[model samples]
Target: MVENEKDLKDLETEQSALSEEETSEQHDAPSEKNESSELEEALGKIASLEAKAEEYETKLLRVQADFENYKRRARMDAEAAQKYRAQSLVSEILPALDNFERALKVEAADEQTKSLLQGMEMVHRQLVSALKAEGVEEIETVGKPFDPQFHQAVMQAEEEGYEPNTVIEEFQKGYKLKDRVIRPSMVKVSQ
Candidate 1:
Protein backbone atom coordinates (compact mmCIF):
# COMPACT_ATOMS: atom_id res chain seq x y z
CA MET A 1 0.00 0.00 0.00
CA VAL A 2 2.87 2.41 0.75
CA GLU A 3 4.44 1.61 -2.62
CA ASN A 4 1.22 2.37 -4.46
CA GLU A 5 0.90 5.70 -2.58
CA LYS A 6 4.48 6.67 -3.50
CA ASP A 7 3.84 5.79 -7.20
CA LEU A 8 0.76 8.05 -7.23
CA LYS A 9 2.77 11.00 -5.79
CA ASP A 10 5.59 10.55 -8.39
CA LEU A 11 3.06 10.47 -11.26
CA GLU A 12 1.44 13.69 -10.03
CA THR A 13 4.85 15.44 -9.76
CA GLU A 14 5.81 14.38 -13.35
CA GLN A 15 2.45 15.66 -14.71
CA SER A 16 2.95 19.03 -12.99
CA ALA A 17 6.51 19.43 -14.44
CA LEU A 18 5.27 18.65 -17.98
CA SER A 19 2.44 21.20 -17.60
CA GLU A 20 4.94 23.93 -16.52
CA GLU A 21 7.19 23.19 -19.51
CA GLU A 22 4.17 23.41 -21.87
CA THR A 23 3.18 26.78 -20.38
CA SER A 24 6.70 28.18 -20.87
CA GLU A 25 6.74 26.86 -24.48
CA GLN A 26 3.37 28.53 -25.21
CA HIS A 27 4.62 31.94 -23.94
CA ASP A 28 7.89 31.80 -25.95
CA ALA A 29 6.11 30.76 -29.18
CA PRO A 30 3.66 33.66 -29.07
CA SER A 31 6.53 36.19 -28.54
CA GLU A 32 8.49 34.77 -31.49
CA LYS A 33 5.43 34.87 -33.73
CA ASN A 34 4.70 38.49 -32.80
CA GLU A 35 8.34 39.56 -33.39
CA SER A 36 8.36 37.89 -36.84
CA SER A 37 5.09 39.60 -37.84
CA GLU A 38 6.41 43.00 -36.74
CA LEU A 39 9.60 42.53 -38.79
CA GLU A 40 7.54 41.68 -41.89
CA GLU A 41 5.37 44.78 -41.48
CA ALA A 42 8.42 47.03 -41.07
CA LEU A 43 10.01 45.61 -44.26
CA GLY A 44 6.81 46.22 -46.26
CA LYS A 45 6.63 49.83 -45.12
CA ILE A 46 10.28 50.42 -46.03
CA ALA A 47 9.75 49.01 -49.54
CA SER A 48 6.79 51.29 -50.17
CA LEU A 49 8.71 54.35 -48.97
CA GLU A 50 11.65 53.47 -51.22
CA ALA A 51 9.34 53.18 -54.25
CA LYS A 52 7.83 56.60 -53.61
CA ALA A 53 11.28 58.14 -53.24
CA GLU A 54 12.31 56.78 -56.66
CA GLU A 55 9.19 58.19 -58.32
CA TYR A 56 9.82 61.63 -56.85
CA GLU A 57 13.40 61.59 -58.08
CA THR A 58 12.30 60.87 -61.68
CA LYS A 59 9.70 63.65 -61.63
CA LEU A 60 12.23 66.15 -60.30
CA LEU A 61 14.67 65.29 -63.11
CA ARG A 62 11.97 65.75 -65.80
CA VAL A 63 11.04 69.17 -64.45
CA GLN A 64 14.67 70.23 -64.44
CA ALA A 65 15.03 69.14 -68.08
CA ASP A 66 11.93 71.11 -69.12
CA PHE A 67 13.25 74.24 -67.44
CA GLU A 68 16.57 73.88 -69.25
CA ASN A 69 14.81 73.59 -72.65
CA TYR A 70 12.74 76.68 -71.99
CA LYS A 71 15.81 78.72 -71.11
CA ARG A 72 17.62 77.62 -74.27
CA ARG A 73 14.68 78.52 -76.54
CA ALA A 74 14.35 81.98 -75.00
CA ARG A 75 18.05 82.64 -75.50
CA MET A 76 17.86 81.66 -79.17
CA ASP A 77 14.85 83.94 -79.76
CA ALA A 78 16.63 86.94 -78.23
CA GLU A 79 19.70 86.42 -80.38
CA ALA A 80 17.57 86.13 -83.53
CA ALA A 81 15.70 89.35 -82.70
CA GLN A 82 18.93 91.29 -82.31
CA LYS A 83 20.35 89.90 -85.55
CA TYR A 84 17.30 90.72 -87.70
CA ARG A 85 16.33 94.05 -86.12
CA ALA A 86 17.30 96.12 -89.22
CA GLN A 87 15.32 94.00 -91.69
CA SER A 88 12.24 96.23 -91.95
CA LEU A 89 14.19 99.48 -92.34
CA VAL A 90 16.38 97.99 -95.07
CA SER A 91 13.44 96.52 -96.97
CA GLU A 92 11.74 99.95 -96.99
CA ILE A 93 14.87 101.59 -98.53
CA LEU A 94 15.12 99.11 -101.43
CA PRO A 95 12.60 101.02 -103.63
CA ALA A 96 14.53 104.30 -103.33
CA LEU A 97 17.75 102.58 -104.32
CA ASP A 98 16.08 100.97 -107.34
CA ASN A 99 14.83 104.41 -108.52
CA PHE A 100 18.34 105.85 -108.16
CA GLU A 101 19.71 103.07 -110.36
CA ARG A 102 17.09 103.86 -112.99
CA ALA A 103 18.13 107.56 -112.95
CA LEU A 104 21.79 106.65 -113.51
CA LYS A 105 20.88 104.49 -116.52
CA VAL A 106 18.80 107.32 -118.06
CA GLU A 107 21.34 110.15 -117.38
CA ALA A 108 24.36 108.34 -118.74
CA ALA A 109 27.37 110.49 -120.04
CA ASP A 110 26.43 113.62 -118.01
CA GLU A 111 29.29 114.69 -115.67
CA GLN A 112 26.98 115.99 -112.88
CA THR A 113 24.76 112.95 -113.13
CA LYS A 114 27.90 110.71 -113.06
CA SER A 115 29.06 112.21 -109.74
CA LEU A 116 25.53 111.89 -108.26
CA LEU A 117 25.30 108.31 -109.54
CA GLN A 118 28.62 107.39 -107.93
CA GLY A 119 27.46 108.73 -104.56
CA MET A 120 24.14 106.91 -104.81
CA GLU A 121 25.88 103.70 -105.78
CA MET A 122 28.22 103.97 -102.81
CA VAL A 123 25.29 104.54 -100.44
CA HIS A 124 23.40 101.59 -101.85
CA ARG A 125 26.46 99.35 -101.51
CA GLN A 126 26.87 100.45 -97.87
CA LEU A 127 23.23 99.72 -97.14
CA VAL A 128 23.48 96.25 -98.68
CA SER A 129 26.67 95.49 -96.75
CA ALA A 130 25.07 96.53 -93.47
CA LEU A 131 22.08 94.28 -94.18
CA LYS A 132 24.38 91.35 -95.02
CA ALA A 133 26.18 91.81 -91.70
CA GLU A 134 22.77 91.62 -90.00
CA GLY A 135 22.00 88.23 -91.66
CA VAL A 136 19.56 89.48 -94.35
CA GLU A 137 19.89 87.49 -97.59
CA GLU A 138 18.38 87.98 -101.08
CA ILE A 139 16.28 85.11 -102.40
CA GLU A 140 17.62 83.71 -105.69
CA THR A 141 14.69 82.54 -107.84
CA VAL A 142 15.78 83.38 -111.39
CA GLY A 143 15.98 80.42 -113.84
CA LYS A 144 15.29 77.92 -111.03
CA PRO A 145 12.36 75.69 -110.09
CA PHE A 146 9.40 77.61 -108.61
CA ASP A 147 8.51 76.84 -104.99
CA PRO A 148 5.31 78.31 -103.56
CA GLN A 149 6.83 78.50 -100.09
CA PHE A 150 9.80 80.62 -101.23
CA HIS A 151 8.43 82.03 -104.54
CA GLN A 152 5.05 83.53 -105.41
CA ALA A 153 4.08 82.63 -108.99
CA VAL A 154 2.83 85.78 -110.71
CA MET A 155 2.63 84.34 -114.24
CA GLN A 156 3.11 81.05 -116.07
CA ALA A 157 4.45 80.54 -119.57
CA GLU A 158 5.26 77.62 -121.89
CA GLU A 159 8.89 78.00 -122.96
CA GLU A 160 11.16 75.75 -125.03
CA GLY A 161 13.57 73.50 -123.12
CA TYR A 162 12.09 74.64 -119.74
CA GLU A 163 10.46 71.99 -117.55
CA PRO A 164 6.81 72.37 -116.54
CA ASN A 165 6.24 74.19 -113.19
CA THR A 166 9.69 75.78 -113.54
CA VAL A 167 10.21 79.50 -112.82
CA ILE A 168 9.87 81.39 -116.15
CA GLU A 169 10.40 84.86 -114.74
CA GLU A 170 10.50 86.88 -111.52
CA PHE A 171 8.56 90.20 -111.60
CA GLN A 172 9.44 91.33 -108.10
CA LYS A 173 12.45 90.32 -106.06
CA GLY A 174 12.10 88.51 -102.74
CA TYR A 175 14.27 88.68 -99.60
CA LYS A 176 14.84 86.45 -96.62
CA LEU A 177 16.01 87.58 -93.20
CA LYS A 178 17.00 84.08 -92.19
CA ASP A 179 15.74 80.51 -92.36
CA ARG A 180 12.20 81.93 -92.56
CA VAL A 181 11.00 83.19 -95.94
CA ILE A 182 9.80 86.74 -95.17
CA ARG A 183 8.46 87.39 -98.70
CA PRO A 184 7.75 84.87 -101.44
CA SER A 185 9.23 85.66 -104.85
CA MET A 186 6.90 87.11 -107.51
CA VAL A 187 7.69 84.68 -110.32
CA LYS A 188 6.31 83.29 -113.60
CA VAL A 189 6.16 79.53 -113.53
CA SER A 190 6.51 77.53 -116.77
CA GLN A 191 3.54 75.40 -117.70
Candidate 2:
Protein backbone atom coordinates (compact mmCIF):
# COMPACT_ATOMS: atom_id res chain seq x y z
CA MET A 1 0.00 0.00 0.00
CA VAL A 2 2.90 2.50 0.70
CA GLU A 3 4.59 1.85 -2.75
CA ASN A 4 1.29 2.51 -4.61
CA GLU A 5 0.86 5.91 -2.89
CA LYS A 6 4.43 6.91 -3.82
CA ASP A 7 3.88 6.00 -7.49
CA LEU A 8 0.62 8.05 -7.61
CA LYS A 9 2.43 11.14 -6.16
CA ASP A 10 5.11 10.93 -8.92
CA LEU A 11 2.40 10.69 -11.58
CA GLU A 12 0.60 13.81 -10.23
CA THR A 13 3.92 15.79 -10.23
CA GLU A 14 4.57 14.87 -13.89
CA GLN A 15 1.02 15.97 -14.89
CA SER A 16 1.50 19.39 -13.09
CA ALA A 17 4.84 19.97 -14.97
CA LEU A 18 3.15 19.35 -18.39
CA SER A 19 0.27 21.79 -17.48
CA GLU A 20 2.81 24.52 -16.61
CA GLU A 21 4.58 24.05 -20.01
CA GLU A 22 1.21 24.40 -21.84
CA THR A 23 0.35 27.61 -19.95
CA SER A 24 3.73 29.17 -20.86
CA GLU A 25 3.27 28.11 -24.53
CA GLN A 26 -0.17 29.79 -24.66
CA HIS A 27 1.35 33.10 -23.36
CA ASP A 28 4.16 32.93 -26.05
CA ALA A 29 1.62 32.44 -28.88
CA PRO A 30 -0.16 35.79 -28.09
CA SER A 31 3.24 37.61 -28.09
CA GLU A 32 4.03 36.13 -31.55
CA LYS A 33 0.62 37.25 -32.87
CA ASN A 34 1.21 40.82 -31.57
CA GLU A 35 4.64 40.92 -33.29
CA SER A 36 3.15 39.83 -36.64
CA SER A 37 0.39 42.49 -36.46
CA GLU A 38 2.94 45.21 -35.66
CA LEU A 39 5.16 44.13 -38.62
CA GLU A 40 2.14 44.32 -40.99
CA GLU A 41 1.25 47.85 -39.77
CA ALA A 42 4.86 49.00 -40.28
CA LEU A 43 4.89 47.68 -43.89
CA GLY A 44 1.59 49.51 -44.66
CA LYS A 45 3.06 52.82 -43.38
CA ILE A 46 6.19 52.37 -45.55
CA ALA A 47 4.09 51.81 -48.69
CA SER A 48 1.97 54.95 -48.01
CA LEU A 49 5.11 57.08 -47.59
CA GLU A 50 6.55 55.77 -50.91
CA ALA A 51 3.31 56.64 -52.76
CA LYS A 52 3.35 60.21 -51.38
CA ALA A 53 6.99 60.63 -52.46
CA GLU A 54 6.13 59.59 -56.02
CA GLU A 55 3.30 62.20 -56.22
CA TYR A 56 5.62 64.99 -55.06
CA GLU A 57 8.24 64.00 -57.69
CA THR A 58 5.68 64.36 -60.53
CA LYS A 59 4.57 67.81 -59.30
CA LEU A 60 8.17 69.00 -59.01
CA LEU A 61 8.91 67.98 -62.61
CA ARG A 62 5.85 69.89 -63.92
CA VAL A 63 6.85 73.07 -62.07
CA GLN A 64 10.38 72.84 -63.50
CA ALA A 65 9.05 72.54 -67.06
CA ASP A 66 6.70 75.55 -66.61
CA PHE A 67 9.53 77.74 -65.28
CA GLU A 68 11.71 76.86 -68.28
CA ASN A 69 8.89 77.81 -70.71
CA TYR A 70 8.34 81.15 -68.97
CA LYS A 71 12.04 82.01 -69.27
CA ARG A 72 12.10 81.20 -73.01
CA ARG A 73 9.04 83.36 -73.79
CA ALA A 74 10.43 86.32 -71.81
CA ARG A 75 13.69 86.15 -73.81
CA MET A 76 11.82 86.22 -77.16
CA ASP A 77 9.70 89.23 -76.12
CA ALA A 78 12.82 91.19 -75.11
CA GLU A 79 14.50 90.43 -78.44
CA ALA A 80 11.49 91.67 -80.48
CA ALA A 81 11.28 94.91 -78.48
CA GLN A 82 14.96 95.60 -79.06
CA LYS A 83 14.66 94.92 -82.80
CA TYR A 84 11.85 97.50 -83.25
CA ARG A 85 12.91 100.05 -80.65
CA ALA A 86 13.91 102.78 -83.18
CA GLN A 87 10.70 102.60 -85.26
CA SER A 88 8.81 105.51 -83.68
CA LEU A 89 11.71 108.00 -83.65
CA VAL A 90 12.56 107.34 -87.30
CA SER A 91 8.96 107.92 -88.35
CA GLU A 92 8.97 111.27 -86.54
CA ILE A 93 12.21 112.38 -88.28
CA LEU A 94 11.23 111.44 -91.86
CA PRO A 95 9.35 114.72 -92.70
CA ALA A 96 12.23 116.85 -91.45
CA LEU A 97 14.69 114.77 -93.52
CA ASP A 98 12.55 115.32 -96.62
CA ASN A 99 12.54 119.12 -96.04
CA PHE A 100 16.32 119.17 -95.71
CA GLU A 101 16.73 117.25 -98.97
CA ARG A 102 14.36 119.61 -100.83
CA ALA A 103 16.27 122.72 -99.61
CA LEU A 104 19.60 121.24 -100.79
CA LYS A 105 18.14 120.58 -104.24
CA VAL A 106 16.75 124.13 -104.51
CA GLU A 107 20.19 125.63 -103.78
CA ALA A 108 21.76 123.75 -106.74
CA ALA A 109 21.21 126.82 -108.99
CA ASP A 110 24.35 128.48 -107.51
CA GLU A 111 26.89 126.41 -109.47
CA GLN A 112 30.02 128.24 -108.10
CA THR A 113 29.22 127.22 -104.45
CA LYS A 114 28.59 123.54 -105.38
CA SER A 115 30.95 122.24 -102.66
CA LEU A 116 28.64 123.53 -99.90
CA LEU A 117 25.63 121.83 -101.52
CA GLN A 118 27.62 118.64 -102.14
CA GLY A 119 28.65 118.53 -98.46
CA MET A 120 25.00 118.85 -97.39
CA GLU A 121 24.07 116.08 -99.84
CA MET A 122 26.76 113.77 -98.39
CA VAL A 123 25.46 114.37 -94.83
CA HIS A 124 21.89 113.64 -95.92
CA ARG A 125 22.98 110.40 -97.61
CA GLN A 126 24.83 109.30 -94.45
CA LEU A 127 21.71 109.90 -92.34
CA VAL A 128 19.57 107.83 -94.74
CA SER A 129 22.19 105.01 -94.87
CA ALA A 130 22.29 104.78 -91.09
CA LEU A 131 18.48 104.43 -90.90
CA LYS A 132 18.55 101.75 -93.63
CA ALA A 133 21.17 99.73 -91.78
CA GLU A 134 18.82 99.49 -88.76
CA GLY A 135 16.14 97.66 -90.83
CA VAL A 136 14.19 100.80 -91.79
CA GLU A 137 13.06 100.43 -95.42
CA GLU A 138 10.76 102.54 -97.59
CA ILE A 139 7.67 100.78 -98.96
CA GLU A 140 7.83 100.97 -102.74
CA THR A 141 4.28 100.95 -104.05
CA VAL A 142 4.76 102.72 -107.41
CA GLY A 143 4.24 100.40 -110.43
CA LYS A 144 3.81 97.39 -108.10
CA PRO A 145 0.97 95.37 -106.63
CA PHE A 146 -1.20 97.43 -104.26
CA ASP A 147 -1.49 95.77 -100.86
CA PRO A 148 -3.90 97.07 -98.23
CA GLN A 149 -1.52 96.13 -95.47
CA PHE A 150 1.33 98.28 -96.80
CA HIS A 151 -0.42 100.77 -99.14
CA GLN A 152 -3.44 103.07 -98.70
CA ALA A 153 -5.28 103.61 -102.00
CA VAL A 154 -6.29 107.26 -102.07
CA MET A 155 -7.73 107.04 -105.59
CA GLN A 156 -8.75 104.34 -108.05
CA ALA A 157 -8.06 104.95 -111.77
CA GLU A 158 -8.95 103.20 -115.05
CA GLU A 159 -5.60 102.88 -116.86
CA GLU A 160 -5.12 101.60 -120.40
CA GLY A 161 -2.08 99.33 -119.77
CA TYR A 162 -1.90 98.73 -116.00
CA GLU A 163 -3.47 95.64 -114.45
CA PRO A 164 -6.32 95.95 -111.94
CA ASN A 165 -5.26 96.50 -108.27
CA THR A 166 -1.82 97.66 -109.48
CA VAL A 167 -0.36 100.83 -107.91
CA ILE A 168 0.34 103.47 -110.61
CA GLU A 169 1.50 106.32 -108.33
CA GLU A 170 2.78 106.73 -104.76
CA PHE A 171 1.66 110.20 -103.59
CA GLN A 172 3.46 109.90 -100.24
CA LYS A 173 6.26 107.55 -99.26
CA GLY A 174 5.72 104.86 -96.59
CA TYR A 175 8.17 103.18 -94.23
CA LYS A 176 8.57 99.77 -92.65
CA LEU A 177 10.43 98.45 -89.63
CA LYS A 178 11.62 95.05 -90.75
CA ASP A 179 8.53 93.05 -91.70
CA ARG A 180 6.17 95.48 -89.91
CA VAL A 181 4.91 98.56 -91.76
CA ILE A 182 5.10 101.76 -89.68
CA ARG A 183 3.12 103.80 -92.24
CA PRO A 184 1.13 102.70 -95.29
CA SER A 185 2.05 104.32 -98.64
CA MET A 186 -0.51 106.71 -100.11
CA VAL A 187 -1.00 105.37 -103.63
CA LYS A 188 -3.26 105.51 -106.71
CA VAL A 189 -4.42 102.05 -107.80
CA SER A 190 -5.63 101.14 -111.30
CA GLN A 191 -8.89 99.31 -111.76
Best by lDDT: 2
What tens-digit string does per-residue lDDT give for candidate 2 at 111-174?
7668788888899889888989898888988789999999999999999789899999988778
Instruction: Kindly list the per-residue Cα lDDT of model 1 for residues 21-139, writing each as its tens digit.
Output: 54764464334457778677667656855765675576457557666776798899998888778768767866765576566566658798888888877987787788777776778
Using alpha carbons, what is the TM-score of model 2? 0.71
Score candidate 1 by lDDT. Answer: 0.72
Clash count for each candidate, listed in order shown: 0, 0
Candidate 2 residue runs with Cα over 4 Å from true position: 1-33, 102-107, 112-116
Candidate 1 weakest ten by summed lDDT: 24-33
Clashing pairs in 1: none
